[model samples]
Target: MRFYPYKLACLLAFGCFVSVTWIKSIPSDEGSTVMPDLQILYKRLLVAEELGGQVSQDLSSILEQLRNLSKTGNDTYLYSVHNRTGFKVSVVLGIPTVKRDKQSYLVNTLSSLLFSLTSSQCQDLLIIVFVAETNLDYVNSVAETIMKNFPKEVQSGLLEVISPSQYYYPDFTSLKETFGDSKERVKWRTKQNLDFSFLMLYAQDKGTFYVQLEDDVVAKSGYYDEMKAYATNEASKPWLYLEFSQLGFIGKLFRTRDLPMIAEFFLMFHRDKPIDWLLDHILWVKVCNPEKDDKHCTEQKALLKQRYKPSLFQHVGLHSSLPGKLQHLKDKDFGKQTLYKAHNNPPAEVSSTLKHYQTHSLKSAYEGRDFFWAITPLQGDYILFNFSQPVYTSGYLFRSGNIETNGDKFFNTTVEVLPSSVLARHKVAIPHYRESGNGFIIVGEFVNGLAEGKIEAALQPVSALRLVVHSDSDVWALLSEILIKV
Candidate 1:
């Protein structure tokens, strides 16, 4: 194994430099139940090994191959690429769902997507929900909910809800009987692959790229913005596919042109095994020539696949589609997400109304410990942070109200960023979680007080920041940690 050094530079997406480690490690077993990290260990193979002698000689040949693969396919009988607003679509998010007896996560999942995405990112994005259940009434009901919740997007042609025609995808009765009762898992999974294929085909012609996700998943904040940054960073590089989420068929990204080949591959092995394993086999074979005698190519090809560190999508707690399965899905990188390193130096001065909760003082706000709780919340409460001088502000994070002890209580926080020179201010809405079905509390560290929401306003160097409640606090506010990037 060869380790490649990727220069620690400004992440084209975040506008800041970050250090990334490169290491040479052995590959994990393919059959293991745990999903491998699948990070593309960057190596300059062409410059280090092959291209030194033939840079100019084989440039045309390489360019020609890329052109062939990237060219729009000759098949005109593709999905009807419809956008009601006439906006050019760049990303197609494909979600395939089924009827569940007790658990439904589609509303939560859709809500997460909308809240996490910025208006700029949503402009060129299309979300296609494919209802792949045998019950037509269930499908229509789900579609109605989607239409009602996201009327703006649905009317704007930003979202599409459809189901596979029965003529194309018949009842899986024969498949179930073929797999038999004892092999229920196999039968469920086999039908799942067919459904995925249907989703891919439907989305293939709608956009430049396609990503498949399950019905029950929540996205990280600023996911679309982060993807744009990642794409910018990867513009000069060659990659086979990009994996966004670690779950099954949830975050596999592909070029729309490649969907035909992938859908075909899925159908070819639909009866043989699970769709996830089938994807692994196909991608491996697609990148590495199975007929080639050289074994080194396989190792090199494996590095072409990439994934976002600390995965961006989390699975919602729900009953599994397959019987006898319980799900408590959590990514290793959920609440622990640190977009950038914390600025060690605190602001010039920090003060709050009811500054002391027992022994916990507002001075210990940045103590870097969750144990030292600096807590207080009252009517017309505010935390005023003053800076001696102007600083280029990137973002701010504040954790309020411990959840383990108090059971998920948060105060509605309104953050105001006032630039030293400008009259305008940057305002970010920090929502508190109510019993109502809504978004994850903005910057709420419910589990351990660790959530951080980035600033989305355009502003100059900051002079000060203010955190306060938009309404009267129904519960006592607890301030665990307050962070700002200078």
Candidate 2:
């Protein structure tokens, strides 16, 4: 072994020999908090600097192996080494090495230690090995040493190795053909490393959801539970592009069908753009077509409009530079408090009638009793509504002491009052009202008797009246469209 004196001297100067202790088990329940033994492993590596020569190399090799294992196969073993009972302790070790150190000798010693630990732990785990420069001959030698040192139960089929070569590679000719420029080449290569690692892990594991993490990020408390909930929700929908971390641009929950189209689009127009810019273009430009087979395109557009129409949540803005900022704002509290409120206060009296609406209530008299509202037919349109008033306030407008609709019972667009507005007498203007159209509008007052009623307003042809109502809690107002007009 050709020992580099400078490396040896540096290792000797730093005190390296250290004992590592860790917890032995992973938390099994949802919402249970568990920290991996990374802190202990880091401490061990820090101390290994003082061990000098072979011992230092051994520690470095072990650390490298652990990192590699995370990216390897499905059966990668995770353990915590502990000196106590009822609680298992898992141990991890790392050794650092320069490019021109005695790599083979270091690998052999680390492999021997891992074999010993695995035998004692009596747990089968996936082993990960990482190295700067990897050759099959040296890797095989390390594997052979581990197998020879440990029992078959501990060593058999328990190791996985991941190297830079596996993650980074020569350019893919197919990708090159699709994206010809060198800048695109670089971007694709970066994407390849990220995407392929995830794909490989997903392919290898039988776990319901695959979680891919970058090296610099640390898991937060309850991260696993949060991820589980997110995965479960995502599984119910047909999302194709799911991002775990914020990409500094528009982060989206994409429909699965749209993924291939997006990928193709990227190949054509975004091969050379920065990652964030590429993502923005994909979200803003490429994915907005309503004619796509996947309904998510339409759904996303609507969601985007609902969320980002104003610069309310910086992340929800059409031109928002900050993605995911809306997530921090509760839907109800979004514009209530701030130096500048993003959402405007509701109008005191909205005179709009329901061109079309659906309340699912058979008795028109009960409309004031039940809750109802309206949303825009177009994606991302604002929801408009009036305050909920008591039925007594609306009774003054009805003729037969109760509000009534003719034969169009199943999908009638009836207007109702909230329970709170029993004393106020207000007149509202019906804007753009017509009669020879598809939708109907109703306006009535509920007093001692249902009276002062009108129902002549008509909607555009092919459009039906959607349900309309008012809300009272936050800001008092008028007008609401609860359902889409067909």
Q: In model 1, which residue pairs have backbone atoms overlapping below 3 Å?
A: 445-449
Question: lDDT tens digits, residues 208-274, model 1?
Answer: 7677888888777567767656755774566656777777667777778777667666765676678
CA lDDT of each candidate?
Answer: 0.57, 0.30
- For model 2, what is the alpha-carbon lDDT of residue 431? 52
Question: How many angstroms is residue 335 displaced in model 2 relative to the true structure, after the best TM-score fit?
Answer: 21
Model 1: number of backbone collisions: 1
Error of 1 at 462 (Å): 14
Q: Tell me the number of clashing residue pairs for each predicted model.
A: 1, 75
Candidate No. with top lDDT: 1
TM of each candidate vs. truth: 0.55, 0.25
Model 2 residue 291 lDDT score: 62
Give the distance in Å from residue 373's predicted Cα in candidate 1 to where it truly belongs.
Answer: 14
Worst 10 residues of 1 by lDDT: 13-22
Error of 2 at 362 (Å): 66
Q: 1-486, model 2: which lDDT tens digit per residue?
A: 110100112122112221111122212346755446786556555545343344435444533443355444333332111111222112111121112221223333232223212133434223333332235455444434534443342234333222333322323343433344464445444443333222222122222333222211222222233434564555665344455344232222333234334433333332245444554555556457756655767656443321221111112212111221122322222233111101222222233323224652212222333322322222212222343321122111211100111111112123432222212212223453322212223343222111234333121111111233222222122221122111
